[model samples]
Target: MSRRRHENFRELLSKREGFTVSQVSFQNEVLEAHNYYRDLHCAPPLQLDNKLSRSAQIFAEELASKNQFYHSNTKGVGENLYMASGSNVDSLTGKLSSNQQISSSFSYANIAGDAPVTDWYNEIEQYDFDYPGFSGATGHFTQVVWKNSKNLGVGIAYTSEGDSVYVVAQYTPPGNYQDQFPDNVFPEGQC
Candidate 1:
């Protein structure tokens, strides 16, 4: 492991909860063991909507009228091996088709459809999110390719009735927001 790279990761790990840095360096290989983790993709960004109405004028009105609480979170793993395995992999060329991760939005409502979508999660659907326990957490996240190519990805997920909502807008800086390293991620492919 390169000494510079190893030190860089060790410093990053120090910021996580319960991380303790050892004043003594060469004595232990524990810090060196974490080198490989540097290659893993960084976690997706979490942007909280201060107002639910920002999703879209019509969609927002539908949400407020129902007296339901709706929350949306998106995550895009630049290169998803699990999802890509299903199709479109040109092994001959190093350029593999990147895939998006699963992102879900759930609402707190007695009447599922009443959350305004009225039949979204139940009817006009693309993929059903079924996992035993976490019922409310069901939605689709976007996919971002790490490659240096111009590509546009559209992710529209609401449910069989209305499981998720996507709202696009320029982010107004929040007072408490901690911008991740290098803006969105850790120096992109370098990290």
Candidate 2:
């Protein structure tokens, strides 16, 4: 993977290929990713009436107003009410409300495209294991966010860690979740 700090989405876009680089004009990746995740998990499509829709617009405004936004790409992209997290989420990624409700949720902002893994299946084919996540991890993913008053925001996930990149979008409401388990023993929740 490239060691140079991405600084901002613009800088990051410049490093990517297959799309015209622009903060405002370049949204295919965002839309595609959102759609892909939405369908895979069968989540609701973007609703104009939802509060998250407005949040997305304000985020775009903030990004456009900036002269040159810069951020680090070393860490994976994520956000939580208390602290952003990865694998250790169930441990320390949320803040329960006075009513004992978890106040934060996660959603993929972008996810469209297919990176054929079979193409990488070559005993004799050399691989670029150093490319971001792993060898044969084709395609790209990204995101840009702006939090509300408490305003906790996170940038796109710049990683080569998927089989494809379609069905992506730019906004996801907090608290939304997917039903990953039907027979799960845990009390019936969004899981």
**TM-score versus the correct structure, for each prediction:** 0.17, 0.23
Tens digit of lDDT per residue, candidate 2, span 92-112? 213222243211111122211
Model 2 lDDT, residue 104, Cα: 12
Candidate with maximal TM-score: 2
> Please, what is the whole-model Cα lDDT of each candidate in the order they appear?
0.23, 0.25
Mark the regions of model 2 whose C-alpha exceeds 4 Å error after superposition.
1-21, 47-172, 176-191
Shift of residue 77 alpha carbon in model 1, Å: 19
What's the alpha carbon RMSD for model 1?
Answer: 21.8
Worst 10 residues of 2 by lDDT: 141-150
Model 1, runs deviating above 4 Å: 1-41, 51-53, 56-139, 143-191
Q: Candidate 1 on 123-190: residue-level lDDT in tens?
A: 21332222111112211111121112122211111222222233221122211112222232232254
The Cα RMSD of model 2 versus the native structure comes to 19.0
What lDDT score is found at residue 173 in candidate 1? 28
lDDT of 2: 0.25
